[model samples]
Target: MAARHSRKLLRPLLYTSAAAAAGAGVLYISYRPRNIPGLEAPAVPPPGYREGKLVPPSFPSIKSRLEQIQDLKRSNDEEEYDLLIIGGGATGAGIALDAATRGLKVAVVERDDFSSGTSSKSTKLVHGGVRYLEKAVWELDYNQ
Candidate 1:
């Protein structure tokens, strides 16, 4: 008699638990950050790291400031140029190329060599955030 009553309660409890689990799975898949007003754009490559087949970033120890940047006029034989580029990083390089192509005299200066700053320290993969693998691992463990 007691066993029969226990079974009756168990059936409904199991059904409720299964429904809740299914609902959670559905929510996890469908939900993602949509339009959060005033939220800043995510980082180019996120903080952690990544592994791939590409030339890794290299850094110098104590940069004693390049002469070209410190004394622009001294480095240059000409008085002035049409465009004076600030850094020799990727963006700056692109700017210089564009200006030069347009028949404008251009000069680019960098405290260090090309991409020597943070840009130089990139891990090859262009369109990915750094913590991608970590996120994947987390998602795998995080059962909805």
Candidate 2:
């Protein structure tokens, strides 16, 4: 009679243990790390830290650069700029560069500092125009 009672009690325990073990197995399998092929670390270092070569950033590093920047600021404060760029964004900087290259004096003034706005955000993309690339390809002759 006791053996019969013990067997009945043991049956539920065994089923519970088996179910728990199966759940744990499923969890382990589901959460296991999968092996992906062809994924690799970057081969090239990012700009400014080029392939173990250290490049110092421009700032108050030297006295002459500081003096030059101060002189430019003073000049901007005193007189009107020929090409006054309001922002230090890519567009403004590019315009300034283009104007200066064409022999026009340019001055860029930013409320914050150069590249302190959305220009400094890493989430933004800087890509060559897709249409320009397509046009160049279209113009190319395969025979050449």
Candidate 3:
């Protein structure tokens, strides 16, 4: 008898919860920003918008870039690289950048896109480091 009464109570509670959820969803959809007036994407081209080229031509053209890749591949097979970094994440990219700055012929090859691992994922907090620092200061822990 008590189980039956409990279930009867649960059914109404579930229905009301579901109705509230649906109403919240409708509210969110109706009240959300369409666009900020000034921030709306320009209909006509904005200043300095190029027609044909996206970036400046002083940067290597597509053909030159392809040729450079071919040449690099050929040379890499024949000649040993000064620094051959395997990944494209923070550590690998940093090492490659450091080596290149030091006048080394650095090559970084990754199975996935750049920063596809740790760098892409969220730490899931704002001011996390600052909070940590505040806690450490409060606790008087220097090692942290």
Candidate 4:
């Protein structure tokens, strides 16, 4: 008898919870920033990317996002890209950026989260690449 009463109560609670969820969904859809005046929608680029800077994507967690990406790679047959980079280190990322800027179909695959590898592992000073640079040349490096 108590189980029956509990089940009866649960049915209403579940229905109410679902209704609340649907209402929240509708509220979210109706309250988007793009629906407001003088607001621009978010930018999404071709082949699953945002056309923008070097910043890591905003996510709940970098590790979780990377795991999701790995799942996608395992499940989906990706498009044939002109450039496929294997890491998110500085050199790999630079190559990806260069190819993308040149209007090529570039996709970079980082094994770990962005900057989790040799890119940030360097102990050298930031400007150590081109040492003793000529002032007039507009190129400076300390490694020269």
| Highest-scoring model, lDDT | 3
The lDDT values for all models are 0.66, 0.66, 0.70, 0.64
Ranking under TM-score, best-scoring first?
3, 4, 2, 1
**lDDT by residue for model 3 over 49-94, one digit each (tens)?**
3676564324333444456467667884558789878876777776
* Residue 37 displacement (Å), model 2: 52
The positional error of residue 94 in candidate 1, measured at the CA in angstroms, is 0.2
Model 4, 44-87: lDDT tens per residue?
A: 42234457645554543345675756755765455556777887
Cα deviation at 42, candidate 3, in Å, is 34
Q: Flag clash pairs in model 1.
A: 46-130
Candidate 4 overall lDDT versus native: 0.64
In Å, residue 63's CA in model 3 sits off its true spot by: 8.8
Question: Which pairs clash inside model 3?
Answer: none
Model 2 lDDT on a 0 to 1 scale: 0.66
Candidate 4 wrong stretches, greater than 4 Å: 1-78, 119-144
User: Candidate 2 residues 86-118, lDDT tens each?
Assistant: 877776666676676655778677666566676
